[model samples]
Target: MTKIPRGTIAIEEAVLNPDGISWMAESATLFNTGADPKKASSHGHTPQLLDIHESRLAKMDAHSVEYMLLSLTSPGAQGEPNREKARKLAADANDWLAAEVAKNPARFGAFAAVSMHNAEDAVFEAQRAVKQLGMFGIMLNDYQVVGEGGDAEGKKYYDAAEFDPFWKAVEELGVPVYLHPRYPQTKDLERGTRYGDRKQILGAAVQFHLDLSMHIYAICSSGVFDRYPGVQVVCGHLGEGIPFNLWRADHWYNKPVKKATRPSKEDYSYYFTHNVSITTSGNFNTAGLKFCIDQIGAERCLYSIDYPYDTIEEAQDWWKGVDLPADQKEAIGRGNAIKLFKLPLEL
Candidate 1:
């Protein structure tokens, strides 16, 4: 196995039970629970499997992954309708994650789960996760699905003024926020499925990333970064299409366009430089990774496998051999993660 630079960490690796209600599985089941028995079967297994130390250690050994920053599976605490249930679930998930990380401190760190529905609870959990549990950061599934009329059509967003308390607490805590993707809104379902069955899957992957990316962009453009300059936000799957079309996004910003938000000379790319980062989980394409590096710089990239949806061996095999300058490779493989997460240097 190839050796990466010392202190390399995969910041976006998932840790969840197989039976957990993952956003991907739940969204797919939206059509018919019976249509896909596989969905129901895999629901609770994600966290259990992700928390298994032996399996994760074996995977790390096989892949030469020195450290993995673990997060609760998607929609774990985010999908709950009751705010109190959401809070309890977040606490339960964080407790589980903390214990799992304690099992192998040298090889693991955690991203705490928080219920965003109640901003106060979200802040309290954030503090507990970082200050007490020693988690590296917090993982927020795209948007807080609060009620029935919260989609794009309804234009309800977590970044709205109502959620400032949550954002303020995040800033105060001084930990990064890993914004993971979730399914698209119901209003946009048809647009996502126009291609085929594959389109729905592929499009959802594409759309979820874009949705999260745009939300972050909105938060940034809305002066969130300016207010809380020290706060860091991370996205997975190579920044969810932002790197691929950054130039187009910038060009459009320059052109005349209707703007609900005030136009600023600063482009979206500017914000990424100061406050954003991304990981390579579930996106193993070398060409795309290289492109992302070129667009965002290696300092902003981290390596991840998106396990158990993806195998560590496969991601490691591809990443360990990708063609890039040694400095760039080291940064993407581990240096960036170490610096971003403030991980201990043990490798």
Candidate 2:
């Protein structure tokens, strides 16, 4: 094992059970993860994704990572079309994660999955996951897939007046909500013919960030933060390209067009700085880290590997060489995550 780093934590790690693999493989329509479950193990990362024991924990130990905050992977329950099935998948997945995390609470924490299809049920499940199962926070894969088998009719994002109850519950619970990424819905995918040439990069390469950033747009532009300002939102891939465009976003939100349509009391950058956090999950570029730190400061940036998808060796290799002061590195690499997520890790 590598020399132990002091209190290092990865905030956006993903986990899924065998049942979830089976379900998603068979039912998944929106994202490529479910494209063909039959060849699931073909990715060669299944052992890493499935085993928190030897493979995962060993990787963490090998890289000097002290702890990991796990969450249901993308297109988890949120991809299910049936509300009841989605609810069950969420509860079961959380329970399974809780059981696994119970085995090594010191090395692992988890975010509970929820179906955004029903605001009320999602609120209840979020409460149960935190209160009953001792989960740390909630995970939402962009939006709810309400349409049966990936149709465009069932798309739902929680930015309207209707999701107030859910937002209110999250604020009351005091746990951060992680806004993770997923592929565009089938309808949007159809419209994405503009990228027909290199559409191969749609899911995780180019479009995943584009797709997830829109939900971030909804969260900010739709006034969810102005009302429940205490609710914390986290995004991977260095703020999902927000920090790079914060200036323009702030300027545009102040313009008449955005001002008339939304109820946000502050500029886009205000809510982003006050209520959101970013992680170095997959995009581990030193320049991006430098830029985000310059834009949002190190306090709102956290370290992560987007594990199984992003290897520990590669993330650690890049993170170890990040050009910054020791204090800033400590803050982003670990301190921020512990404080923001209320992680039980000791400094």
Question: Which candidate leads in lDDT?
Answer: 2
How high is the lDDT of residue 65 in model 1? 79
lDDT (Cα atoms) of all candidates against the true structure: 0.73, 0.82
Alpha-carbon deviation at 145 in model 2, angstroms: 0.4
Worst 10 residues of 1 by lDDT: 195-204
Which pairs, if any, clash in model 2?
A: 147-154
* Clashes within 3 Å, all models in order: 16, 1
In the range 175-238, model 2's lDDT, one tens digit per residue, is 9999988765455555446544445676666777887888898788877898898999999989
RMSD of each: 4.3, 3.1
lDDT for model 1: 0.73
Question: Which parts of model 1 are misplaced by more than 4 Å?
Answer: 1-8, 17-39, 44-51, 148-156, 184-199, 202-204, 255-265
Which lDDT tens digits does candidate 1 get at residues 179-209?
8876545554454454233343443355566
Name the regions of candidate 2 deviating beyond 4 angstroms: 1-7, 26-44, 149-153, 186-198
